[model samples]
Target: MDTTSDRSRQWQWPQWILRAAAIYNLVWGTWVILFPHHLFDWTGVARLNHPGIWQAVGMIVGVYGIGYWIASSNVLRHWPIVLVGFLGKIFGPIGFLGAALRGELPWSWGATILTNDLIWWLPFAAILYGVFKIHSDPASRIPSVTRGSLEQAADAILPRPQSSNGKSIDSLSRDQPILLVFIRHAGCTFCRETLAVLATRLNEIRGLGLEPVVVHMSSLEEGERLLLSHGLHDTTHISDPGCVLYRHYQLERGTVSQLFGPAVWWKGFQAAILRGHGVGRLSGDGFQLGGAAIVDQGRTVQVFPAANATTSLPIASELRTTLQCAAPIPKAL
Candidate 1:
């Protein structure tokens, strides 16, 4: 396959658009710095007491132009920069709309919003989506798992909890079905999102005869803090900072698209912002991916590899449907 040829053909328009945005940013930033008062006069905005602050904002916008120019060379690799720009673009418009509604900003200020934020939204969003679509198509299948090794892998991950009173995952699966949920770092917004979801649905899941066991790549104390905040203070979780169980279950590290693409940002906004599960301090590798598996006795029945770090989980009703489709439960561990 000619990857270079493919990339060249696919990226022609996107590269042009990125460069266009770079030029626009440079020109706009220069204008704002050279005559910051012109913008206030034109938009009917009140003059800022500190004009230098406005000029500094222009400098930041001009710096973003440099980042956009560099990103045009490889939009997929430099997507985080693009995402940051896009987020700014998104929030800026919302801020302007709010201020205008409150009569703090003139309606004419929308002209700046139109040029600085709205116009670039679609193109930046499209580039992000394009990167996601292109990168998500797996190039090849993962190494095959023979039954013997698969069982070994399952056993390695579901071994008895080291504490004296803790039950093994295998033992838990023996009497009923189990939902083994792998999580990223404790501080990840998506991890907090997952905790939020589970906090609401855990009882319903238990009613469906499935016990949810959370696995995290963080210290137990940190994991407890995240879970407890989300009303999951009593949830059973495994803290595996080394990711030993993650590898055994074949959860790979995330790529840039999987971690920071358009879809991730959108869903993250809903989870971390709209849902009020605010992000917090970093606890572990932010790029570590997670997954879910259904276990019955010692055998793994179903696996859902996470498409991205921020993939929204299936709701309780959906899990019930999956549980219905899973392999029959056994009687003993």
Candidate 2:
């Protein structure tokens, strides 16, 4: 029943529509970048009294607009970037709404918010919807993680032994519920901070009848060194250099790359800024990455995956809540 003509027609429409949307976003983004002050004036957010502040705002908005243009142009190829842009489009308006409701934001900002937020929402939504449609099409079917499969896979992938440890993950937590703290490699400052927090909260975590097991994508030697530096030498640790666990738990990078195409410069810039301020330090080797998941008895009870390394994971309380409701598993005999 399917012919070349039928296939060509099917591919033709979506591609044409996507290209049109990309052009629109590119044009709009360029406009905003070229005249950020005018765009801000139109939006009614109070004009910055300081030229320095205006310059900063212009730089930020211009960079974001360029990101939007690139993402929209290659929606299918860079779906993650497009998705992030869409998130900004949606949340930017919500933020304005909240500001207006609280009387902290001026009504004038709504005009610019309309241009930046509301105007993009429909198109972004359409692009997202189209992406899903394409993904769902019979021709484009790809294996995805469902809750059930993910739970099963998480169990299998997580319980392995590091060659150095000579101990299995399950063996380390035989007497208590394992608090598997999945972390990014040493390149992430947040991960280092998290290790410090875990050290500080060791007693509390143990009090809850749980044993902490730290997981990272570094070598066991590197992981141990980092943990020792933070005075967490006693905590059990595992190295997952290949990110096999990351893939198994569906903690892969999100849609950001679809727009900006792996932002090495941005990542480096952030690292430089962090280091300059004495706030955070990036890995000298540039192995910066992010994603975390908590598993218990083969079930993915919690995930804190981010599109980029800059964001922080939820704190201990939120992590505990996620673990508390972890799907029940059979008690060991």
Candidate 3:
């Protein structure tokens, strides 16, 4: 199970929040380091016995800012950093309360806690909660990949929903080879690119004696609309919002770099901006990853997990070569 994927989803807050937290920490740390007395002066609290300790605390807070900055790159992978920061934010106030009660710290010191720690609690907490929720949900769980024969894997995707007025996946692949195309989302720029390529090469694919079926984590209506827009209305599709088959086939989620790196951004620019295919409303889990497979006679001949969100599907020529290579040789007379 790719826990990172689960982290990426359902927490759609902009990256700027993390960036802002980082900047705030750095500035605040610098201020405290240079003028620890300002806080004491404003709160009317006597200075600490060792003012250097306050400076040391500022240094620690600034280090946390660096952690937050790194986490901004990919919060899911670097979640422990955020967890530590959140804990500090929580404990800072509790420690303050104990000090005030003991007359060791001024009540006004809570104002510093408000600015330095309390404000960040909810957003950080929200991210952690989202992480917990995704892992706990049985429906979205990612099943481990079985290191067994293709026939065993095929069994996992069984009882698959029949395509609109078409045969079940098992039935369709029983007599002929089928290319299973797992799509990321209908609104993805790369997915649009995939649609355009398939629409242009459908005839060539047919000539190679391969049937392509699309699996998406969106409603049937949304899938139909997207395919129709791309002139692929006739493409066979299966809607699996629960991602049951996805997990069964071991299609784990993508990581931060895989989904939103520079390469992905460049490809997206070409697809949506330069190519004039505008982005659409998100129709499925934006973080749900995708891949491809060749299923024949209840057996998987090839599996191609997408390298990233922007990965291109293997073109028809590539699939043809793979099929030719995997085909059984003629038996001796």
Top candidate by TM-score = 3
Cα shift from native, residue 20, model 1 (Å)? 29
Expressed as tens digits, the lDDT of each residue in 1-333 for candidate 1 is 344345644577778888898999999899889998888987667899989999998999999999998888877667788999999999999998999899999888888899999989888988887776554322211122322454454444433223112676677677777787887777678888887788888888788788787887666676667667778766677776545566667787787689889999998888888988778776655667888877777677777789898864566766777777767443222
Give the per-residue Cα lDDT of candidate 3 at 216: 83
* Residue runs of model 3 more than 4 Å from their true location after superposition: 1-138, 141-162, 327-333
Scored by lDDT, the top model is 3
Once model 3 is optimally superposed onto the true structure by TM-score, how far is the C-alpha of residue 247 displaced, in angstroms?
2.1
- After superposition, the stretches of candidate 2 with alpha carbons farther than 4 Å from their true spots are 1-164, 254-294, 297-300, 304-316, 329-333
RMSD of 3: 11.7
Ranking by lDDT: 3, 1, 2
**What lDDT, from 0 to 1, does candidate 1 have?**
0.74
C-alpha lDDT of all candidate models, in order: 0.74, 0.57, 0.75
The collision pairs in model 2 are 43-112, 78-258, 80-255, 80-256, 81-255, 81-259, 155-298
Error of 1 at 260 (Å): 0.9
User: How many clashes show up per model?
Assistant: 0, 7, 0
TM-scores of all predicted structures: 0.50, 0.42, 0.58
For candidate 2, write residues 116-207 as lDDT tens digits.
Answer: 66776776676676665454232222223322454354344433326335665555545456666666557655566567667888888777
Model 1, poorest ten-residue lDDT window?
137-146
In angstroms, how far off is 262's CA in candidate 1?
1.7
lDDT of 3: 0.75
